[model samples]
Target: MIVNEWCMYCGECAGVCPQCVIEVCETGLKFDEQTCEDCKFCVMVCPVGALEKDEQK
Candidate 1:
Protein backbone atom coordinates (compact mmCIF):
# COMPACT_ATOMS: atom_id res chain seq x y z
CA MET A 1 0.00 0.00 0.00
CA ILE A 2 1.02 3.62 -0.51
CA VAL A 3 0.68 6.00 2.40
CA ASN A 4 0.56 9.55 1.21
CA GLU A 5 1.64 12.68 3.06
CA TRP A 6 -1.91 13.28 4.21
CA CYS A 7 -1.60 10.46 6.69
CA MET A 8 -2.34 11.48 10.27
CA TYR A 9 -0.87 8.44 12.02
CA CYS A 10 -4.25 7.59 13.43
CA GLY A 11 -3.68 3.84 13.27
CA GLU A 12 -6.98 3.17 11.55
CA CYS A 13 -5.37 1.15 8.77
CA ALA A 14 -3.38 -0.97 11.17
CA GLY A 15 -6.49 -1.70 13.16
CA VAL A 16 -8.40 -2.97 10.14
CA CYS A 17 -5.68 -5.11 8.61
CA PRO A 18 -6.81 -8.72 8.87
CA GLN A 19 -3.29 -10.05 8.35
CA CYS A 20 -1.86 -7.63 10.92
CA VAL A 21 0.74 -6.58 8.37
CA ILE A 22 0.50 -2.85 9.04
CA GLU A 23 2.01 -0.91 11.93
CA VAL A 24 1.62 2.73 12.89
CA CYS A 25 4.68 4.28 14.44
CA GLU A 26 5.51 7.73 15.73
CA THR A 27 7.04 8.79 12.43
CA GLY A 28 4.97 6.82 9.97
CA LEU A 29 3.35 3.53 9.07
CA LYS A 30 5.09 0.28 8.28
CA PHE A 31 3.81 -2.38 5.91
CA ASP A 32 4.91 -5.97 5.79
CA GLU A 33 4.44 -6.52 2.08
CA GLN A 34 5.65 -10.09 2.32
CA THR A 35 2.71 -11.09 4.50
CA CYS A 36 0.11 -8.77 2.98
CA GLU A 37 -2.81 -10.42 1.24
CA ASP A 38 -3.66 -7.41 -0.93
CA CYS A 39 -7.00 -7.13 0.81
CA LYS A 40 -6.93 -3.32 0.50
CA PHE A 41 -8.83 -2.90 3.78
CA CYS A 42 -6.27 -0.40 5.00
CA VAL A 43 -6.65 1.76 1.94
CA MET A 44 -10.40 1.82 2.25
CA VAL A 45 -10.47 2.70 5.95
CA CYS A 46 -7.98 5.55 5.92
CA PRO A 47 -9.93 8.56 7.23
CA VAL A 48 -7.68 11.09 5.51
CA GLY A 49 -7.47 9.13 2.27
CA ALA A 50 -3.77 8.77 2.86
CA LEU A 51 -3.62 5.14 1.87
CA GLU A 52 -3.84 3.63 -1.60
CA LYS A 53 -2.99 0.36 -3.27
CA ASP A 54 0.40 0.53 -4.89
CA GLU A 55 -0.51 -0.69 -8.35
CA GLN A 56 3.12 -0.86 -9.39
CA LYS A 57 3.86 -3.35 -6.63
Candidate 2:
Protein backbone atom coordinates (compact mmCIF):
# COMPACT_ATOMS: atom_id res chain seq x y z
CA MET A 1 0.00 0.00 0.00
CA ILE A 2 0.99 3.58 -0.64
CA VAL A 3 0.02 6.50 1.52
CA ASN A 4 -0.05 9.73 -0.38
CA GLU A 5 0.13 13.28 0.91
CA TRP A 6 -3.65 13.37 1.22
CA CYS A 7 -3.60 11.34 4.43
CA MET A 8 -5.44 13.02 7.23
CA TYR A 9 -3.96 10.79 9.94
CA CYS A 10 -7.41 9.81 11.12
CA GLY A 11 -6.38 6.25 12.06
CA GLU A 12 -9.29 4.76 10.17
CA CYS A 13 -7.01 2.69 7.94
CA ALA A 14 -5.11 1.34 10.92
CA GLY A 15 -8.31 0.41 12.70
CA VAL A 16 -9.59 -1.76 9.84
CA CYS A 17 -6.37 -3.56 8.91
CA PRO A 18 -6.62 -7.23 9.84
CA GLN A 19 -2.87 -7.78 9.55
CA CYS A 20 -2.03 -4.84 11.83
CA VAL A 21 0.30 -3.43 9.20
CA ILE A 22 -0.85 0.15 9.62
CA GLU A 23 -0.36 2.04 12.84
CA VAL A 24 -1.62 5.50 13.68
CA CYS A 25 0.39 7.45 16.20
CA GLU A 26 0.44 10.95 17.65
CA THR A 27 3.09 11.96 15.15
CA GLY A 28 1.58 10.31 12.08
CA LEU A 29 0.82 6.99 10.41
CA LYS A 30 3.17 4.04 10.43
CA PHE A 31 2.99 1.36 7.76
CA ASP A 32 4.73 -2.01 7.96
CA GLU A 33 4.90 -3.23 4.38
CA GLN A 34 6.33 -6.60 5.35
CA THR A 35 3.27 -7.37 7.45
CA CYS A 36 0.81 -6.10 4.88
CA GLU A 37 -1.31 -8.69 3.07
CA ASP A 38 -2.42 -6.45 0.20
CA CYS A 39 -5.94 -6.75 1.55
CA LYS A 40 -6.83 -3.25 0.44
CA PHE A 41 -8.87 -2.80 3.63
CA CYS A 42 -6.86 0.28 4.45
CA VAL A 43 -7.49 1.75 1.05
CA MET A 44 -11.20 1.27 1.38
CA VAL A 45 -11.25 2.74 4.86
CA CYS A 46 -9.20 5.82 4.07
CA PRO A 47 -11.69 8.67 3.89
CA VAL A 48 -9.22 10.98 2.20
CA GLY A 49 -8.08 8.52 -0.51
CA ALA A 50 -4.55 8.62 0.83
CA LEU A 51 -3.94 4.88 0.57
CA GLU A 52 -3.52 3.25 -2.82
CA LYS A 53 -1.97 0.22 -4.49
CA ASP A 54 1.71 0.54 -5.27
CA GLU A 55 1.08 -0.55 -8.88
CA GLN A 56 4.76 -0.58 -9.68
CA LYS A 57 4.72 -4.26 -10.41
Candidate 3:
Protein backbone atom coordinates (compact mmCIF):
# COMPACT_ATOMS: atom_id res chain seq x y z
CA MET A 1 0.00 0.00 0.00
CA ILE A 2 1.32 3.42 -0.92
CA VAL A 3 -0.49 6.67 -0.27
CA ASN A 4 1.00 9.19 -2.57
CA GLU A 5 0.82 13.01 -2.57
CA TRP A 6 -2.55 12.79 -4.25
CA CYS A 7 -4.17 11.51 -1.07
CA MET A 8 -6.56 13.93 0.60
CA TYR A 9 -6.25 12.05 3.91
CA CYS A 10 -10.00 11.83 4.18
CA GLY A 11 -9.78 8.17 5.25
CA GLU A 12 -12.10 7.30 2.42
CA CYS A 13 -9.86 4.49 1.31
CA ALA A 14 -9.46 3.21 4.85
CA GLY A 15 -13.12 2.33 5.10
CA VAL A 16 -13.06 -0.11 2.21
CA CYS A 17 -9.66 -1.58 2.97
CA PRO A 18 -10.35 -5.10 4.30
CA GLN A 19 -6.85 -5.41 5.73
CA CYS A 20 -6.97 -2.01 7.44
CA VAL A 21 -3.87 -1.07 5.50
CA ILE A 22 -4.62 2.64 5.57
CA GLU A 23 -3.66 4.68 8.63
CA VAL A 24 -3.70 8.41 9.25
CA CYS A 25 -0.11 9.42 9.64
CA GLU A 26 1.50 12.75 10.55
CA THR A 27 1.70 13.76 6.90
CA GLY A 28 -1.34 11.83 5.83
CA LEU A 29 -2.59 8.27 5.47
CA LYS A 30 0.44 6.07 5.98
CA PHE A 31 -0.17 3.00 3.86
CA ASP A 32 1.20 -0.19 5.41
CA GLU A 33 2.34 -2.48 2.64
CA GLN A 34 3.04 -5.30 5.07
CA THR A 35 -0.67 -5.88 5.59
CA CYS A 36 -1.67 -5.08 2.03
CA GLU A 37 -2.82 -7.88 -0.27
CA ASP A 38 -3.10 -5.63 -3.36
CA CYS A 39 -6.82 -6.13 -3.32
CA LYS A 40 -7.23 -2.62 -4.80
CA PHE A 41 -10.41 -2.15 -2.79
CA CYS A 42 -9.13 1.05 -1.21
CA VAL A 43 -8.40 2.54 -4.61
CA MET A 44 -11.92 2.03 -5.86
CA VAL A 45 -13.57 3.24 -2.66
CA CYS A 46 -11.61 6.48 -2.44
CA PRO A 47 -13.91 9.31 -3.33
CA VAL A 48 -11.03 11.69 -3.86
CA GLY A 49 -9.14 8.98 -5.74
CA ALA A 50 -6.26 9.24 -3.33
CA LEU A 51 -5.28 5.66 -2.71
CA GLU A 52 -3.29 3.91 -5.48
CA LYS A 53 -0.93 1.02 -6.15
CA ASP A 54 2.77 1.59 -6.85
CA GLU A 55 2.31 0.36 -10.43
CA GLN A 56 6.06 0.15 -10.85
CA LYS A 57 5.66 -3.09 -12.70
Question: In the order shown, what is each candidate's alpha-carbon RMSD?
Answer: 0.8, 1.6, 2.0
| TM-score winner | 1
Q: Which candidate comes out best when scored by lDDT?
A: 1
Pick by TM-score: 2 or 3, better one: 2
lDDT of 2 by residue, 1-57 (tens): 677889889888888999998888877777887888888988888888998888772
Summarize candidate 3's per-residue lDDT along 7-57 as a digit string, tens digits: 777777778889987787676777677788888988898776665588772
Model 3: colliding residue pairs:
none
- TM-score of every candidate: 0.92, 0.81, 0.74
Off by over 4 Å in 1: none
Q: Candidate 1: global Cα-lDDT?
A: 0.90
Question: Hey, what RMSD does candidate 2 come out at?
Answer: 1.6
lDDT scores in order: 0.90, 0.84, 0.75
| Winner by lDDT between candidate 3 and candidate 2 | 2
TM-score, cand. 2 vs. native: 0.81
Candidate 2 segments whose C-alpha is farther than 4 A from its true place: none
